[model samples]
Target: MDQAITMNKTSFGTATTGKLGMWLFIVMDGLTFGAILIGGLGLRIGAESWPAAGSVLNVPLTAFNTFLLICSSFTMVMALNSIVRGDQKGLVKYLILTIAGGVLFLCVQVWEYSHFIIGSEHLESILKGAGFTGSQFLPTTGIYGSTFYATTMFHGLHVLSGVIYLSIILSMAFKEKFGPDNYDRVEIAGLFWHFIDLVWILVFTVIYLI
Candidate 1:
């Protein structure tokens, strides 16, 4: 029984202290997101008339943004794979691509947020030209806007955090610090990045799609 327990623990990928700690953080962070999502759903269900997200949200733009983020997840995977294969150059290349994807995703999200918050004429015209219809969606607008911003901004912050984390890992990669013999740090970072991507999928579905 003891051996079985040990096997199970090792199977979860906590091969290093860093990996174990990251896994713990991921669990706690996941619960926080779960609570937020559940609370938001409750609020929406209780509200008499929830605003239609599609009307206010620039769906096409956000869909593109989502695609961008998903692509980052792929780049992250390739980065890990490259390091595991003892290809430091490939690792660095993929890391740069992943970081670029994250940066671009954040930029697009900021633009979306600004439009909803300021609703300037120039911005309005730009959005309208892009086929956006709804007006300003400030958090003060109603429950819909409040929940929308709260969830997305929270997730955005996570993406920003992930980007910073990946940047640190990238710096280390540039130093050639990780290799097949000692690449747990890179794997740990990949775990976090992938979690961010997965959570965003859930957020997009709950907040934007339904």
Candidate 2:
């Protein structure tokens, strides 16, 4: 018996659809982040005094956080590979590591927030710490510091939420809910996880490093 099956020039699968949707969200979210980042930069450029991110925030501590996120990305890829290889144990291992990495990253973010104080005090601290003898720094300056705090803190909240979601995904995967035959859900969660990691890369560079 001879049968002929035609393959389409463009074959769209679930992964394609999933990635498309994620990209749409990223585009829209990028616009929002861009506005915030640009506004922060503009205000920073036009300000009398601005706290240098690297100086204020402990780069060593943050570097550890960045490593945590990078490790999570690797763990996510390992999870996907495990699923494709039909190795359930490896899938669980990678997912558990990923979740742990996210948790550790969030903890580092929380620790960073300790350096910040309430309205007037935050400025006082920033000024005093950055070699200011007088009132060189003010919290009311173009709302730059506040906006920076708001945007980055909000992203931290999102990462926390994503970690919770990933934990649930790991729990399900451990129960054998996902395997080689059914791993789209895992991939979808991973897409969001990787997006968080990708977004942090931008945030770290724009907000922290640059």
CA-only RMSD, every prediction: 5.8, 5.0
Using TM-score as the measure, the top candidate is 1
In order of appearance, the predictions have TM-scores of 0.86, 0.79
Q: How many pairs in model 2 have backbone atoms within 3 A of each other, for residues 3 or more apart or on separate chains, i.e. clashes?
A: 0
Worst 10 residues of 2 by lDDT: 1-10
Candidate 1 per-residue lDDT over residues 81-139, each given as its tens digit: 99877899999999999999999999999999887887767655544554444445578
Q: How does each model score on lDDT?
A: 0.85, 0.73
The best candidate by lDDT is 1
Which pairs of residues collide in candidate 1?
none
Clashes of each: 0, 0
Q: Distance from true position, residue 28, model 1, in Å? A: 0.6
